[model samples]
Target chain A: MAEERQQGHKWTMIVDLDKCTGCQACVVACHAENNVPSPSEDEIIRGRANHWIRIERYWEGEYPNVKARFLPVFCQQCGNAPCEPVCPVYASYHSVEENLNVQVYNRCVGTRYCGNNCPYRVRIFNFWAPHFDPPLEQQLNPDVTVRGPGVMEKCTFCIQRIRRAREQANVEGRPLEDGEVQPACVQSCPTDALIFGDKWDENSRVAKMIPHERQFKLLEHLGTEPAVYYLKGGETHVGE
Target chain B: MRRLASLSLRQRLILGVAVVGAGALLVALLAIVIAQTSAADEQPLAFSHKTHAQNGIQCQFCHTGVAKGPVAGIPSVEKCMGCHTYIATDSPEIQKLQGYWERQEPIPWKRVNIQPSYVYFNHSSHVAAGVSCGSCHGAVAEMTVAKPVVEMNMGFCLDCHAEQENKDALWDCTVCHR
Candidate 1:
């Protein structure tokens, strides 16, 4: 029983805001990897687009001397997740093995309570039945389920990839190596903006980068203790 | 319709009972057919596991992916022809298999047992964990045609997983759900 209580690796992601260009590569990669359907133009206009990750751009300084700051935001995978408890059906819960928030699509009754409770506003409710046109259906990832209508989903930090990595590691009779599991967002980031690894591992890139002076959680004061950390962006700004 | 309406209340009651009885009988017959179909779906070739097992062939020889991947893969037509080339050239099933190989068309064998798409069941993990094929698949060696011996459901899976020493990882929903 005590062995079961032991928390394994703390999977964390450190996003270097300085490196982000708001290119939306990570966003596109996420949609492709997770089988998230692209919403219709009208649906997107109505704010029904299901982007697991999105670049939040903020304008700095006056219009004449304006600087664009890109902040890529997704599910933070909080240690004390607000969404977990609010899920009436226990669909949105933290996995003990993975140390990440998991959303069981089959169990979710779509109360949207988890989406509402999320401070990061990462949980997305499936407002309509997903439509994949023609050849697009063939590209759906078999590892990840194509979530149906009336289910709440969010960025899982690519839990399917994590599971695959772990299974391979388990079969090989070795502990999971650092940087072994790369999420779709991390893999697609052209500027190396998203860094993902086990923070518990002292040698991991995330562990080494996590102690930077600019490092801050999304909502530190709210006490969410999010796994994702962002580096402050002002230092790299030109023409200061 | 008018003649039926003109019948006595007692006669009408008897007619109603007779119609209900016939409907129930028809439903029962349909259910039996469905149950049989699910147990052993129609296969292109009537492959018998008993004959193969009795001939000293191992299950792993045909199902090469059973211990390696998520699925216990169906053997290719080439794999079948490898043995059928010299073993049983006269057999009708062997001839049918040869026809598929000649045409280079895959035999669309209907799966007898299948889990829901949502459930991420891995054959390798279970095999590595020392689960016998018969545990979930029943005694295929004795079965002439493949049939679902056990219901592949959450409760059926949990029954064995609960017995394992490490309950945390096994019990976690994401272990199978995600």
Candidate 2:
């Protein structure tokens, strides 16, 4: 049944590194939208912070001539995901319908094998039981699950929103329009750095952006074939 | 008879007990299946589906969210008061609804059908796909109080979904599970 899907939406995201201010708006939006429990100070200190998406800061040049480069990294949604095969349980697998990597929380057994195998280090393990204080509990999105402890979770590109848009389009008896589906990161991007759309649509912003000279992917040499593309910064090839 | 006679009294007694225990377990299992398929959970007010259907009240009139979202939401006491304010005001069931409405409280309606949180079933998509409510929900129009005539396990979903034209897309894990 998995082999049957040959044509469908190839949801893609184009991140222009030049436009990004590294404000962490996407990170905050992801937590709010997905009901991700905030990590403690100790967890952060232990490098166990549960961030679905994070800005990776790098320093270039020496002394006074140093430049700070920010690259927002998350699940690349690899076509040939390393994490997929390593899973004893089929928790991590490619969704042929949406052309995205899916992590089924219910199927996950906390093996952490997927986490270990993931080249992007995007997969996060739930170390403790999830908690939400009073008013914050009221704001939890009914569309997304509040995952329990002992499950693996990563960026889903806000699939709940994708499902919503798809269902709406299906009900209307029409195809999904370009830029109709937006992940939380793309939606909250203040600088419009993150552009998301179905790459299969010839006129989509992502499709148009694909041909640009500045376009590249993170760790392209490894051949993960990620759905995400990165447009290099103007001054220096920081993303490259 | 020869084999039975060869066994000691203690061995025979143990074997007989085991047989009876297994029989009891099988009966218990059958009883559970029967209960799940036919038992109508007692609701706060005996809201009769047959009564409403006969009166030409559409199922979607109360289950407003069925065609719009994931949940087929329970009707609020205010919705009941909208009609019971004039009609059936004296009926005990309607009076129970009136009491809840008078106190500005919601009627605690026990869910007749339930799906786990992991299984992300969307009602709008199913409704849009030309599926009748009775397909999965059974014959609610003919029922007095709605009972789960169908067990909505994974097999129940896959059986119907497999027959669809877009079965390939429907078979994806992320379609129902996030």
Highest DockQ model number: 1
lDDT of 1 by residue, A150-229 (tens): 99999999988888888778766798999899999999999898899998777998888867878888888897879899
TM-score of each candidate structure, all chains considered together? 0.90, 0.88
Poorly placed runs, candidate 1 (over 4 Å): A1-5, A236-240, B1-39
lDDT of 2 by residue, B96-140 (tens): 888888899987777788788888898999999989999998889
DockQ of 1: 0.65
What fraction of the true interface contacts does model 2 reproduce? 0.66
True contacts kept of each: 0.66, 0.66
- In terms of lDDT, the poorest run of 10 residues in model 2 chain A is A1-10
Q: What docking tier does model 2 reach? A: medium
Estimate candidate 2's RMSD in Å. 5.6
Question: What is candidate 1's CA lDDT for residue B162?
Answer: 90
Task: Score chain B of each candidate by TM-score.
Answer: 0.80, 0.78
